[model samples]
Target: MKLNIKPFFIAAVLFFGAFTSGFAQDNLVNSLKLNASEKSKDSFTFTEVINIENTPVKNQGSSGTCWSYSANSFLESEMMRNGKKPVELSQIFSARNAYLEKARMYVRMHGAVALGEGGQFHDVINMYRKYGAVPQSVYTGLNYGTDKNKFAEMSAVLDGMLETIVKNPNGKLTPNWDKAYAAVLDTYLGAYPANFTWNGKNYTPETFAKEVVGVNPDDYVELSSFKEYPYYSKFVLLVPDNWAFDQVYNVKINELTETIDNALKNGYTVAWAGDVSEKYFSWKNGVAFVPNKDFDEMTVQEKAELFNGPKEEAVVTEDMRQIAFDNYSTQDDHGMHIVGLAKDQNGKEYYIIKNSWGTTNDYKGYMYMTKEYVKYKTTAIMVNKKAVPAGLAKKLKF
Candidate 1:
């Protein structure tokens, strides 16, 4: 469904910032910076069928802002895909702006909606459209005394303040409440800079966005497949972190993978959000595929050999996908970028996923997710409308 809305800030569910010095320079190691023996012994070796260049891997330390990191990484790739110079956008700036808006919404809803660090892919688009963009250097948002993001305390404090406002002992709101909220964010993230110098030039976030970033926010659309919603109709996704209640368009299950394959084949990357909570989703080995046998039923040897390479996987049917979603096996657990496609020794297809968790995995923070895993666990995807397949585009009225 690309209705229009798009969490964790990945497995609590996963995101990206690219091209500064470390990861950015490291990204040029190979298309994926693979070691000759990147895979474990007996593990699958992938030859990339389509490798779209993107910025380096990012580490979203101690925070659940993967939605921002992943979407911004997709946007960075989008910039590269369009021939713009690579620039890493600030993931935390989006987080800063979103916290303000989420607090306001929480008060409006009388504290009914869930509010925290988790968000969907479209939250980045919403922030970009509303506040424009800035380079990561312009607003690193590490002002709270750490070299990396650690949101546990800050988010809790912010939530506590919002809950107090919702209590409304005065039975009325004060104009300065939001101002106080902004001050707290400022204290932590530093004020969203009014203007900043970049490449020896002065520009505000909006100008930098228009002149440098050059992304057309409206060109992107969010989509998901759910049996509960009618295909091709716009419906607001009911997931808890989608506090804004943004809409998404629903479609048949196979169309989900078909659309992603078409986009990559045609030189576009996808912002993938879905369940990464499965036991078979081995982030360390950088491979994920559904086993034909259930996890609990697997023998010890079968479990040990799970990530050793390619194997037959259960054929995911529409009913099977629906069952996972209905029973909560499929959830909005993490977000990642789908950069390319690859196949194992047996010729099965896997999507090359760029994760935001850093280079801890075998593929240097890049991993291979079987198409079956994506089709079964995907909650939503936000992709450029121009990349939409021609026939499917018409069917969804894109």
Candidate 2:
């Protein structure tokens, strides 16, 4: 089923940065706190229509590593769905491994690649397939005299080192530069363990990943919807954080939404990447929606109603979504897990999203995102290939 939406003139909303690091969370929380009075006026209520069992919310404190946290959480849910014991996998292990690889690429490209705390869902899967994973208890990535993940000082030092290397001061690059870089990572994020014991058994990262985690990296597929790309074909998502340049299968907007609905109905969760900078995205109230009226045109009551409950949403069209992408309004900003479905007081549907910002929001680290918001702001989603409908899977070549 295709949506025949048409574009119309609407007041523009300001664009914000895409990456959700530890600093960004602090700012978001502060902003929400300041708007407490406005949010308190709302009267929104949600009834859960579907809920998937998953692990507790985690805090990626002082780190820009939501990509790893959300992907690992999704894998934990997959394990539960598969009848395996749910384990809190180490997010930093993957982050550390990916960081090293990314640093290598940055230097190889003469510092042209983006280097920081942003990544795609595919990064976690690729890291698992290559370096394997460890339980969070096994590796917390807190080696720098702190109990939480913090990378500010470490990031500056690494960036400086890379910049110096890119300059080629000696006219001939040193073969041990990679070793030097690895040393810095090891000093901060801790060295990768060659082997470790868990549950009274000894295993290497590879064996543990295969025998215990038991997730097939290939079993998952990343999908997106954009009018510029041919339907049923793959294209590289042009996001800066996608340093690895992963390809996503492009489908019509309706097919993308239908796939998400089908996945949740079948007890599967999704890893979502999208923009969260809209005027109606109220993290404090635990609601995100695309209101029908423009921000400037809305009356005080209408603005309050937006957060209090579901309301009529703007008609999001292919051109509108594409324009947002083209003009840098819809950014690849944050990564989250969509675990369930909910309906507002008026029976409008919303995806129950699990965030990695700890339990601070009205829903305790979870938010209800309206279908219109998802349709308009989404960058992409990663889902278990089996969860996709047979028809859509065929189109995706899965």
Candidate 3:
């Protein structure tokens, strides 16, 4: 969803310009400084605390293909960690299967479930189980001949198909509704092979899933934090993209980040789902941070200028995460994998993120998200249970 933030940006700038003269700071980085150097020195150090393993980032272009890209990347890492040859599983293949499945579900629910450019991580796992998967080179889903996914045209067509089915224009649900949905997918992303040869043997999608993508679907777990839910209990995440109603473990927001940091420190990667719509999220700069509240204590004009760029703070907490979600500040925006940790020039901790948008940005498709940013913006995270601390693992019933 490309938002029009021009007006907001302009307003924010004018609001801040009035204070620039009063606070003629020495350096650009120094001007936006929220915490004193002395205060910052007391904050946690990620490199000193956690170990990380990472690879190059990937890009999913303009499509809502992050679900596939991120999950497949996680699978790739799983293969690597397990000492198997890493293979780029076809994201489009998983996408086509999910697209068809979601359409059927939409018709079943009479268009109640969302039918758009978004989905949950478990959708990939579920689709892989039911329809199997393919290699990237085998099914890229670029029927229009572009190198990357540009789904605007096809999405409209698919949306139209689902809308038509959900209406039941003919007044009777046909048994072949799913077939019609599958036809639309086949037209866009080539027909799935019933039997294809790979590695000198015939294989179907199910067999390929069983043999190639060896990670067990049951091994992965989703975790989130929200005050309404009882801590240490499991509940379905209420995001629209979670069409499967997948249950995620609910923890206190502090525990969520603690577990994530602990997992990364122990050399385990996390599958992350978070909101990326904030102005502070600079994909080009490869950073995500929360605006400084202490700086906001400044005059309105001063606040506006700082808002135009980046500001750092440590207000990220369990309550902050819940309040953001309650106030519609955090949303289900994008998904990625946090593979490592790094610090900025200010020495603040940042989780090294691998995005699915292909290597197109200055950070080559990665984002360094701060601890506060993760606390305030995350929707959910998936990590291996073994990576969690023994105490936390016991609380989670792992």
Candidate 4:
């Protein structure tokens, strides 16, 4: 069925600003920070290798709109990279647009499309292109008096409305249904702006996006690696959150990891969609790596001391990655941004990933993932076409 291709994934990424000589993350790295591994005498030490300037960290809170949050975060960096002043884009504004669009599709497809809080990263860019963009200061989506995003009640009410509309109790759909659905969004997320003045200039969403945001929606591209398809081809990524069924370019695993390294080194940040549910992913500790020892085979002592220090990572291969992906071991559960690169004492590489779960982790809402871990777990990544290496860009025909 055309509607059966949904992947129930939720992405939760934030920004990772530059970590130069005096940047906060670099300073912390210099201190040899130890998070959960404090119990272990020997802890891991990280040194910044490559970093990019970006906007501040944000919280998705109790919502599953990390796709909007992460994509906005990456676009903020892209604006900075393009020499424009940084501004926080409204993540929920894009999400609000997506919700209505998703609703239209769900009803059109007889509820075959999944309806929930989760979404994929590309949805942000697509929404921006279609509905234009807005500033967070212009629309906060906090009408319920909460300081942060909490969507339980609103989502439940919206889902109930969608269920009724899909059932077509009247035996036929009416035009009023769409208007009624939009009213619920306005009641909860607040009425959106038709026009607003910013920095002494009056602008609408479209004008603001063109005059200030200055991002070429076409400049960015999404890519993934899967042995199921021929390398350098493109296919629809099968994930529940990919409700739009957008196709992503396919490449070898080595090329996939190299693309990120090349982007970080060349003043670009990436939006990551992947699985972080492995025994080794520790968001609280702000450390993630593919350990040589498998969790299932490890003894209690080994499991307890997993983060004691740098250890050998699994030699991730294209075949192994495909196996895990096929068996459901690797899932598209969460999403984040790859803002920089770091190296441990053992010289193993880690991607400096920033999460949208607030500034709560050891790195202050920032975390690290081994390149091996990323290669093994990443479902897909979005980056500027220019950020891709000249040779690889030609190969992928980006």
Candidate 5:
């Protein structure tokens, strides 16, 4: 007999601009460049170690759709790397299509599936393989008349409608429910085009994706590292945003870093997903690190040194990573593109992250994440399967 699963509300995983008081101060300090002098004891001196080519930064703007933006950015970079002319694929094209499909899954599961603006990196691949893609000019998803996305009312109305349908007051679902759902999406996000002209040629979304995007969705893989799962094997990433239940290859923490490094070294950029709620993750300073001391416990000098100088970092272990995951300290909160690497004055290495929250940070929508912070806080990452070393790729059976 089939078992019934009940749906319950969890806190939504949307990224907003609400930052803590400490984070606010960090932002102010970063804005003032209070420690920017080369010789200042309170300044961080960084040199670019490795920088990869990528598309320009774009803002997500009042929307919880960084996954779409970052994944699309990754695809755009992939197209450029493949010798194709760069074109900005619409993030909302993927997001809009994914939403409709997710609604169907939620309804099919009798509302047991999680539904929100949050999604995993694989959601883009899945959407691309199914509905195909369009350029940003073709499907802007801004039918509601705002230049940027604001989905509070839309999310509420959609959730309420799905919940009502799941209740099944009439004991049978109507045939038009899907149409009704589509109508709501079309009203807010604009109707997806059946065919459009691009670059003086008439093309459908699939044709545009094939001839223009020029990247194989199947060539990418999502990977993660945790002690709970066997190394070099696949496991479902346990996160609320992973409502699709996508499986990622699990590797040792060191191997995970090696894979990332190898990928970047081999001219590939990574789609990075991790927790950004830690105090050490400074959006304003455009830097993230694993501090030896907690923010509250640090002296004023130590706090200044956080931005201007380097300190000893805790050695992150697989067990430490697993405990954070099991205890909810590590969460899949945001997604960004890992496009390059940098070194601080003390020669500590950091990964260059391209964020989608607009060009507000010190680096103008980019941040430098410490290697320690990445090892400690990352939930999962996506890279081109070819970027993986041949031996590891063979083991993963990619």
Candidate 6:
């Protein structure tokens, strides 16, 4: 999909920074030479809906399980939106379930699939269908005796076991392999609850899903953009974390942003999977923006200042998006909820992202990102079908 990015450029910075000698004069004449200290803001506005409420600030804690943390949070909001009180569902339960499923797939495919501490949004749905879910209060996965979800020891053991099993040193594999896998899960997360009570009612996991949380697993859709596929067509998003390879429709960048905003305006929240490694991504300070100047142009002293202060320039472009992806610079590092939009002290607009990293940061687990930052960084987003704009929805046939 062709992403419209000129609207995001604060000025006519040298396109791609690749001016030929013949065009050098023209390039220098028109090249945006604004100082790194100068500032500008986009002229658009947005408001929040799907009001964030009672979101339990759970920590993933040294695990690459952003997928688990994020989707469980998504379902929590789903419960709240449906008039049930909000609940902090156990992300570790979902994570354990997904790990077992992934191990099965890995062995079945002879280890072709990448297996690690990563997964996609669909993993949560699969967990809901396969093993169901429980509130964090029920099974916190703290059996390892840690206060937070730490998977280093557990994941290493699981991966080693799967690798050994996949090799199948014997000519045949054991039929009880699945049982063995479940045994490992039981050890880590404790046994799944066969029947439990909530709000003075008896319920199993499946019953809780059907009667209480009431989230339709099929109601959500994933969307992404890349040139390899036809725009607005469904394709398996080719990311390692997307182990399910669920087909997500490709749309232009503007449409993606539009869908997110429309969803927020209409009282819906979005599950955002994106890259958070850029220097401008100040999760520590709870802000993200594109500085207008290049880092190479700054002196040693000024470059140090760039780290200490807000960058006014950082020559962002469509190609930088491509380069980052191609060079492995942009990656599916984290998942968060885009809960609202806001303008910074400089009047620059930023998408208000609610993160699961706890309320330790200056903004208490929230980050503000500009349009450029979102475009360059987002890997994919899942939102309610109703969140899609009318035009974009019709294009994708909703």
lDDT (0 to 1) per candidate: 0.78, 0.80, 0.68, 0.78, 0.78, 0.67
lDDT tens readout by residue for model 1, 129-183: 8988999988988998998776667766787798889898788998888899999
Candidate 5 lDDT over residue span 133-218, tens digit each: 99999899898888877776787788789999999888999988888998999898998788999889999999988888978989
Model 4 Cα displacement at 38 (Å)?
A: 4.2
Model 3: lowest-lDDT 10 consecutive positions: 12-21
Range of the 10 consecutive residues with the lowest summed lDDT in candidate 4: 14-23
- What TM-score does structure 5 among the candidates reach? 0.90
Q: What is the lDDT of residue 264 in candidate 6?
A: 73
Which consecutive 10 residues in model 1 have the weakest lDDT in total? 1-10
Model 6 segments more than 4 A misplaced: 1-51, 300-318
Q: lDDT tens digits, residues 318-391, model 6?
A: 56766777776666656777777765445655677777666655556665677677877777888878778888
Give me the candidate number with maximum lDDT. 2
Over 1-398, each residue of candidate 4 has an lDDT whose tens digit, in order, gives 00111122111221111001111222222222322565432386889998789788998766666677888999999999999999999999998998888888888989887677667777888888887898999899998998877676887788889999989999989989988999999998999777998888998988899999999899989989998898888899987667788999998888888899899888899999887656687766788889887777998888778877777788999888999889877767667888999888878788998877778666788888888888898889999989888888998876
How accurate locally is residue 20 in candidate 6, as Cα lDDT from 0 to 100?
16
Kindly indicate the candidate among 2 and 3 with the higher TM-score. Answer: 2
lDDT of 3 at 56: 54
Where model 5 places Cα greater than 4 Å from the true spot, the runs are 1-13, 16-42
Provide the global lDDT of candidate 4 against the true structure: 0.78
Please tell me which predicted candidate would have the highest TM-score against the true structure: 2
